[model samples]
Target: MKIVIAGGSGFIGGKLVDLLVKNGHEVIILTRSKKTPSKNVSYILWLQEGAVPENELHKVDAFINLAGVSINDGRWTPKHQQQIYNSRMTATDELVRIISAMEVKPSVLINASAIGIYPASYNTVFTEKSAEIASDFLAQTVKDWELKANHVTQFGVRTVFTRFGVVLGREGGALPLMALPYKLFVGGKVGGGKQWVSWVHVEDVVRAIYFALQNDQLQGPVNVTAPTPVTMEEFGKMIGSVLKRPHWLPVPSFAMKLALGRKSKLVLEGQHVLPKVLMANEFIFNFPELKLALEDLL
Candidate 1:
């Protein structure tokens, strides 16, 4: 299939592009760079409110939108927060509008979302069917992001909102930053270490996206996390064990809050999310367990 991917140069998206290319699928990346395209993969420059290449989007097999600002880039100042919200909303809205104008619309529109849509709780395990929406900045941002992507359904296209968790890989996302302290012998649990972290291997994340594209019944919000959800304490232990480091020292809640401000929730708080939709559909995860996932990446 010929797939058009927005933000395909990103960490997870880059891996997905390689996987897609290896699997004999053509990839057209919607990037902001002027980098030359490689074999079976191409690029199209895109910006907010700019002209879209309708010719490239015409009759595409699928449109996978992963464009968004990183929530962990810096402290969540008012301006930073607006950038986070605007980046996702603008990209998704533009995609939906472009796809709507297509003569032969893509069969599927897979939009990247986050599990932040659910309120942070140690006990509650959230699934795709969960109707509860958290009343917070991250939750509302994700809710609005998904709502914008859902607009494609009006044009008879199947829509997918893959709510990602902490995507762990060797190079990018949360693992490297989290592992730095462990390597320096200062690594430990954040806050009280009771917050539940819903995580997944980068490979499994890519697989889930492909699975959603193939499965006709998979629509709406689908959690793209590992089946096993671990607490911050357990997760720290897993990292330490894998890296052969000690996991004892802890970062206090006040220190975290002072450092991250509102973004402290990214580490000090979390949601126990399960890929119930993927499990029901029999989507096998390459690294379902945290220990092995850490070993593979670390």
Candidate 2:
């Protein structure tokens, strides 16, 4: 299969590309910069002036859109928030246009989504079937992003919105920062520590995308979190245990709000998301337990 991935240079995208290539699939990465092509991988310039990426492609089997500004990059100023929203909308719009122009559209489009679409609740467990949507900034961004990506279904392409949870990995995502406090022996509960943290290993995230590509029955929003969801307190202790550090010193919620502003919601609040679709589809998780996942990544 020849797969085209927008924002293929990103954290999760980089790992996904490696997995696809390792599995003997031809991978085309759409990026803003040029990269030297490898044996089973090629990088095509997109989102740049005078670059006709669609013209440089043929019979693309799958299209994965992971393009977006990182919400964790900086404080959520109005300008930064706009950039976050615009980046996803623009990339997805371009993907729709490119797919429309294609003579043979891909079989499936796996758009990167977030579990933030679900409202943050301690007791409420959310799955793909959950219809209650949050009105927060991140949730709204995800909702609109998914709506934009949904346009590809009109082109007869199966669309899957992989709503990712807190992707825990060594290189990127939320692990390093979260583990830093523990490493310094000052990590304990953040905020109330009761807020749920639905985390999945980065490897599981990549594998889930691969599974979505192969499974025809998968469509619409699919939660890409682990089977077990832990509270923030449990998460911190697990990290300490894995790293052999001490989980002490609690950070108050007000301090976090003052420091991170609206971005504080990323840690101070969370949803207990479950991978219902993946489980029903018989997808096996490489690192299902948080302790095991932390040990592997640490």
Candidate 3:
């Protein structure tokens, strides 16, 4: 299959591209960069305002829309908030509009969504069929994002709304950044550490994407997390053990709030999400346990 990834250069998208290519599938990466030369993989330049190149839309067998502004990039200023919304809404609107106009559209449209679509902290288990969107910064952003991507279904296309957890094992993802505190021997739970940390290996994430792509029956919001979801304390211990560092020092919630401001929920709080859709489909995960996943990375 010829796959076109909108944000193929980023963390999860890049990993997916590598796996797709090695699996003997052709890939075309669309970015903000100038046109370059490559084999099997082609590069096309895309921007928020301009139109997608005509041939580029009709050339691929699948379209994976991962283009968006990093929600975790900066402080939650009003301007930054607009950047977060515009980056996702604009890109998704364009992708949906383009695909709707295609003469022979791709069979699948996998738009990247986040587990933030659920309430940040919940005792009740959340599943694909559940609707528990937290009325906060991240939830509102992801909710609107998914709603926009759902528009493609009107055109008779299979739409997969992937709700991702914290992805680990990739070079620059949570592993490297989270390992820093452990390597310094001051790693410990954030806040009280009781918050659940739902996570998955980068490889498993891409695999789930393909599973959704192939399984036309899987539609709507699907949780793309490892079957095992651990608390922040256990997660910190996994990192500490991998780095062989003492994790006794604890960071208080006030410290986190001071540092992260409103975005502290990304770290201090989490959701215990189960990949109900993937598990029901019997999709196998390469790294379901956190220890081996950290070992593979750290």
**Reference-based lDDT, each prediction:** 0.90, 0.94, 0.83
Best by lDDT: 2
Model 1 clash pairs are none
Stretches off by above 4 angstroms in model 3 are: 48-51
Best TM-score goes to which candidate? 2
TM-score of each: 0.97, 0.98, 0.95
Residue pairs with clashing backbones, model 3: none
RMSD in angstroms, candidate 2?
0.9
Instruction: Give the runs in model 1 whose Cα sits over 4 Å from its true position.
Output: 48-50
Residues 73-122, model 1: lDDT tens digits: 88899999999999999888778877877899999999999999999888
RMSD of 1: 1.2
Q: Compared to the true structure, candidate 3 yields what TM-score? A: 0.95
Provide backbone clash counts, one per model. 0, 0, 0
Q: What is the lDDT of residue 69 in candidate 2?
A: 94
Q: Candidate 2 clashing pairs?
A: none
In angstroms, how far off is 225's CA in candidate 2? 0.3
